[model samples]
Target: MIEKIGFPLVLFAMLAIVLVETNIMTSGIIITIGLNLALALVLTQILALLYGFSKSLKILNKTRRHPLYSPAREASVNAQLRSLKK
Candidate 1:
């Protein structure tokens, strides 16, 4: 949820900053600083989301590389081994 909204939030914040600078919207120093801070926060959230995705991908690749990690193949192999033992 946060990841999806982060980008739009950043864009909106940037637009607000532009509006403030252009005097199209009446605002004060505090509002400008607040908008800048909000922009930084949204950007940080985006970075965190990217880092989390990378970590998940790494974990998925590691699991895929394991010899017995495939569910269908492991089930068939298990059945064959049981039949041989019997």
Candidate 2:
């Protein structure tokens, strides 16, 4: 939920800053157009990269492992196994 809204908000803020900077510098039409295109390409690539990273993060958050449990949990489970062996 947070990621859905936050990413675009941040992108727009950054693009606004770049536009303001370019306008302040009085960039010519060709230069401004080129800059905008480059910015678009870079932002698209960044968004794609961020999406992949977030998806992997979501997957990682959902996974569970007994080895990752606390030492106390591991010890209890090990003791149970040893008793069963006997």
Put down candidate 1 lDDT per residue, 1-86, tens digits, no spaces.
98998788767777777777788875877567658867788788899999999999999799879986887986798899999999
TM of each candidate vs. truth: 0.49, 0.36
Please give the distance, in angstroms, between residue 46's alpha carbon in candidate 2 and its true position after superposition. 2.2
Number of the top TM-score candidate:
1
- Root-mean-square deviation of each candidate, in angstroms? 10.1, 13.1
**Which candidate tops lDDT?**
1
lDDT of 2 by residue, 42-81 (tens): 8988999999999998775654343565767757988999
Report residue 16 deviation for candidate 2 (angstroms): 21
lDDT of 1 at 26: 59
